[model samples]
Target: MSRDSLSPRSRLVHDALRDAGIPGEIVTLPDAAATAALAAAALGVEVGAIANSLVFWSDGGPLLVMTSGAHRVDTAALAERLGRTSIVRASAEQVREATGQVIGGVAPTGHPAPLPTVVDEALAEFAEIWAAGGTPHTVFPLTFDDLVRLTDGQVAAVD
Candidate 1:
């Protein structure tokens, strides 16, 4: 059972996870889980095991980047690799508009459309990882392969 409350967006994320054939149960945090570090502590996992779903504005509009909590993304380097002019952090409104989820709770899979995604290779080090479930206080555990399959993201060294 989840310790935190479930939101409409979180439910959508749950459904998406199920539909993607990823076996994970929604977990509710007692307090806010707006950061991967906080979620790692709550879930009793290494910081690197948390998959932080971040949104960026690139040449192609909204881009989803699911990164490892232990590393900071080098947006410029990533943009260069993608042949993008730049990669800027998206605003809260832009995040909501693109993902239909708020800033802190955006899931890697439950977006409004199929967002081009970049997955941090660092996350591949962990066999199991946790990510936000479209709500600040909810999360779900999944394997790296499952995450890649669910999001259809490209694995790269974004940091």
Candidate 2:
């Protein structure tokens, strides 16, 4: 679907991407890609090629971890590496408050404010990766470098 036809949140992501100098167009999936596996199946790509936007509550702040779909985040390991005492999953309300988007559609960017972001180093293995576009049914392709730049993120091992 065209950008004009995108949902409000998806359109916000589209505009944010454009402003960020990303040339990739947002693609609306026929079904909701609420999880990495679903998105991968719909896009016909390896699940690892999907960037999962995971929001965590750490030290009273929100941290966005753009992890690979292949594995779950090792919270303790990640916390230790980041010098954080804890990094627990955010609740649905917290996710929405921090990202201004729902859990399944939280993009790396386009939140109400810029969040401290971490890009999964494992994702660099893929030449191209897809990320949620502010909604579960929308997504866009981007390079690993594009993710780093778009989110102004620090690269780290998420699992």
Candidate 3:
């Protein structure tokens, strides 16, 4: 889709990518890609190639975990790894306030402020990864290294 056709949130993500010198175009899908499974189906790629942006509440406040679709975040392990007291899932309102986007459409970038991010190392297995474009029907492609660089995310075994 053209830049002009992007939603406000998508526009923010688009701009963020551009400013970061990341290469990708936001692609609007014919159907909603609210879940990694749906996004993978729409893109005809393996589900593991979808980077799921998840927000959580940690001792340091909001934390973003960009995980691979093939696995689930191990909160306990993550807490231990981060040396945090606890890491719990953020409520919808908390997510929106932190990321400026809804749960299903949360992107790795374009947040109101920079959030401490941890990206799943497993995602590096895929050459091209797809992430939400600030909306359920939109997405963008990037390399694993580009994603880590764009978010300044620490590479970890989050799942």
Where does candidate 2 stray beyond 4 Å?
Answer: none
State the C-alpha lDDT per candidate.
0.88, 0.94, 0.94
Model 2 Cα lDDT, one tens digit per residue, 105-124: 99998899999998999999
Error in Å for residue 154 of model 3: 0.6
Off by over 4 Å in 3: none
Worst 10 residues of 1 by lDDT: 1-10
TM-score for each prediction? Answer: 0.95, 0.98, 0.98
Candidate 2: minimum summed lDDT over ten consecutive residues — where?
Answer: 1-10
Cα lDDT tens digits, model 3, 1-159, are: 677989999999999999999879999998999999999999999999999999999995999999999989999999999888999999999999999999899999999999999999999999999999998888999999999999999999997
**For residues 1-159, what per-residue lDDT tens digits would candidate 1 score against the true structure?**
542345778878887888988879888889878998899888999999999999999985999999999989999999988888999999998999999988888899777788998989899899899999888888899999888899899989988
Q: Select the stronger candidate by lDDT from 1 and 3.
A: 3
> In terms of TM-score, how similar is model 3 to the real structure?
0.98
